[model samples]
Target: MTTYTLNQENLNAISERVSTPKYNRTQLTTGIVHIGIGGFHRAHEAFYTDQLLHDTSITNWAICGVALLPHDTKIYQTLKAQDGLYTLMVKEFDGSLSKRVIGAITELLFAPEDPSKVIEKIASPEVKIVTLTITEGGYNYNEATGAFDDKNPSILYDIAHPTQPKTVFGYLTQALKLRQQKGLKGITIQSCDNIQGNGDMTKQMLLSYVKLADPALIPWIEQRVAFPNSMVDRITPATTAADIEQLKTEEGIVDAWPVVCEPFKQWVIEDQFSNGRPLWEVVGAQFVKDVEPYEKMKLSLLNAGHSVLGILGALVGYTTIDEAVNDKNIHAFLEHYLKQEVVPTLSDLENVDLEAYIASLLQRFGNVSIKDQIDRICSESSAKFPIFILPTVKANLKLSRQTELAAFVVAAWAIYSLGTNEKDEHLNIKDALKDTLHKQAELASQNHPEYFLEIESVFGNLKTSKPFVDAYVKAYKTITKEGVIIAVQNINLSQINSI
Candidate 1:
């Protein structure tokens, strides 16, 4: 029988580390307000915060987690059930593991439950840095224009009644307004999303929304807020019952909420904070003058490679990336795609060896125990494509010749939009452009094969380039006639070299 409920003993047993030696929980205060409290935050930022708490200098940096959607309430309930204590398991491919109980989060607030409470927390003077892990779609930017969509009801509502309807931007604007009113020191806004120039992106969206709402707050935000771009990497799969049972049996403790992540972790920050930040460099974070090259390397190589594997894995009926990577054709496809197409386009990667990086990525994808799902990776492709594939495509296209391997990725994305697996089973696609894609696919099936390219938001700028258009059309034709596996097999280094 289980011997513990919401007691500190149970928490200590589950974490495998005693809290008394690490953190003075009573002394902790809400200094950092995390906007999107998802699984990634629980595993990554919160994990770092937990480590920083041990130093006592930053015990006050305890996280105040906020959830914007209804679905997140469940996470809130689970965390609250465990007295804000949960286990984070880092599993390696070789079976070595580490587990820790994270207690960095001091409180959880659901926007829907109490919007005022959320705004009040963000407006508080104690909150120093506001971090976000809201997935690509959460930003509410229009893919076509690369700008904020004022037409979005959420944005419109937030703008119409700033204090009444709270969004990440709304909360930020209100908090800044409060800071302005009180003449308090400004805070840094750190974006932990995978988007390139994430800090700039967040600043743009916030300012755009603010300009529409109140023009007066613009200069105030300009002088006070500092948006720092960052590159964050961690492979954390969705938790399952099997994971729960394994932990229960292995550790003799049951945690309603536990985070499982791959052994690999990275956090690269731009080192531009307004009100100061923790000495996270001591805890393995890289603080650099320029994160652009690193950001490009990570987004283009690691993220783009992940997307390629994910789409192909789903189409081939493979559940996890490990299974997909094990297939000879898939493995060869990735190797060729990265080496012949993706690698050649990236310039000035510091001391990074592209070959070694690709090998490491392959190893991570082949970790069968991690079980990173293709569908999970495939979600929010619209937001991911611009960062992951577009730059490579543009770079390859600018060369004297066009690269078919890069074109194949675009073609594969079009094929993926058809919404069926290799077995012809319907696939559940999650994207901001889902409705438009369905209609576009229907039109293509009827007679307008070129309609897919007409998605100006996605392919609009590329459509003007004849070489890219020709490559895309040719690859799309091949995919339609021969299927993905054969198409991928036929692609070679010579084809990319020709471009």
Candidate 2:
């Protein structure tokens, strides 16, 4: 087997080994500065940008990927070493693999290594778009107040040291300030995260941050910057050592940080930009006036469906998402939840077949090649629940619909957070709210399931709703008493009596 490194020079040698960029890599310039350039970005946005780059005319739309956190140092070094080249392998449902070297990222920057450089690059007139995939928790949003978390330590630090900032909001604000001072045009701050009204939320958080840190810039930002709502979907799992070795053995290419995901991909963006934007629509990216319906549909069905399987799968000792989805009981539960409790909450979406979408999601989840970890799906669930599942659950409650399965999803999470499964095995809790959730879960274990719902931010007013509370408690008790497998097999919509 011939060994090769993934880089510009090695492209010719590795053409058959993997899909290399066809165009002149040197001609590509940074027009987009994407923050939080993780697996999903590489798999989705970068993937789309790579396709668009096939057009000889689309030279300036290349990405200068930015990694802000200290933890992202590995990826920064990996991408930097590889000359911004990395392999992306899409695993199809039939077990075939499609491999390509993503070259949309022309450069990589580690903000922690050089904050000033990041701020300067973001302020560059060449960069028309600033994108983020900083995850739901990274926004520092206080859902209760519907504002950016001013009390957060990082936000507070950024507030005090206005110019020498640390957080994402700080970096963005500082850059915008420089751009304004230079009399340069404003840029679009696009969020590709899996949140409802992601663009609106990005605007809200940025504006709030600017208002608190530097009120003078608020007007300029409000007038100039555009935050386009977008709905991005893909199932890129965390990279593992096995994945690394597999790529080397299969493709004969060494990539320090490669991305693997299912073949399915979707991006629906609101066509609002401060400056000229990429012709991404030519490459399968949908630009629309409203992304809210699409957003709701994806969040409610696909995302919430993942959560249900994630929590329940972990409880039932299923490690990967596919394993859980392949299980007859788990698959049935997901199908039922999507068709019964989830779909009713979503209003009509144009050109969308909701039933077919749900069917596809189940099929996607069952794709064995992807190997998306159930633990990964359940990770940051504290942030996930309010954004993904809670909205649909709330909508169902408002409609006087039975949310037994939805409520069960919540109970599954609560039980899973107890730090043990039905078999008394240790369970990993990966949430910012872990300690608090564990304490609440401990109380719920003592036959006080309502205690879990008392976390007002997560459960909201649903904690006080008698019917929801009752359904959740009953579900919690059934899982606790009969074991997860028994509870799962016993789940039936017909058995759920209305409160």
Candidate 3:
């Protein structure tokens, strides 16, 4: 019988002889608690933490992984089974692959299983920095207003009993409360999600929660916590059975929990740690005075670009980004959209070449081995579109020109909401807006494209802008009548020339 867990002997053997040199494990003097332990965290932040672990100078940065949802119990079990040993598969084009075993994680905790355990861990004096990848929706903000929805029952509960509620913000609030009561030094809360101004957003949500729960703690938290903005990128695909088989075949050891990612990775962080931080610069993490421009460039371009391909790929019946990007029409559509429509709106793109970045993004998209799924990318459109795509459209329209590429994205989303693809089959519409999308689709069929814009939470203040509304309506009409292929081919670029 084949074993599922990697025994200590196997782990030691693999660690000692793995092709990629294992970095020295930092001694555990201090703790870095990471919430939302998922594939992306394992593939991205943990990978960086592993690098820091290898650097002997940083001996205090140990990671204690926490999962809030019950489903995460399985992941916790898997990681525990292997003694927190997992292989990270770095995939490249031309069929090149490298596998490395990551071992930076020191312990795992489940929030629902033991909420007090989570609180104690977060409140511990040993824990200095708290990083999160709780996803876009995990913030539990109002989808329509893009603000903290105090009305949410969970939020309400957290307010009433701050320490007991099992939410990320609640956990942070309670932990901060403990810190205040104990006179312990404050910990930095680093947000690793793709939301624009993620750190600030996290702070706002936490502070808002605090205001309703314990107004007295507000000043203390404001004085202590440092919510530093950061920009992180990596293409870590969900693991599949084939990936497991490949690992077993290549390494001669069974790895139940392995992470797969594209070769491309980038992390830009603001150097604003409150308690302390790792010497991540030694492992290629860029620390800067201000990460705003970089964050905007990434959130608006790379993330927005991914959304475009994701929706377009679904329409074209392609599963992975590589499949969609390889199509000449899709590639051209994305290039024109990013270069002509998206890049021009950003006033502070810095010294980076926009054209080169788009080209490199396309190259990354075309990497078949990366296997980034369009469905995965499109999973949370309601949360993603407003943050990633709509901002660019608004910026482009404010310049007094309608961006056809931006319009294309809006239209593509509308078509995607229709509940069927070009193949006339049900397209799995995974989003918080699923129930209402069909209604919106019905409105679109009636040539009322503004119905989609009326989604106040996602479109926000931009829905009232005449230029944006008109252009979006026109694009929606075009897609509804002529379809995505012809609509994309016929976008008028000259309409958005003047600022």
Model 3: per-residue Cα lDDT over 257-287, one tens digit each:
7899988888999999898888888888999
Runs of candidate 2 with Cα error greater than 4 angstroms are 493-499
Better of 1 and 2 by TM-score: 2
Candidate number with greatest lDDT: 2
Q: For candidate 1, lDDT tens digit of each residue in 380-422? A: 7877887798888878777854566667777777777889876
Residues 108-170 of candidate 2 have per-residue lDDT tens digits of 899988889999999998999999999999888965446677889999999998677789999
Q: Candidate 3, after superposition: displacement of residue 285 in Å?
A: 0.6
Candidate 3 stretches greater than 4 Å from native = 1-4, 7-9, 16-27, 492-499
Q: What is the C-alpha RMSD of each candidate to the true structure, in Å?
A: 2.2, 1.6, 2.5
lDDT values for all models? 0.79, 0.89, 0.81
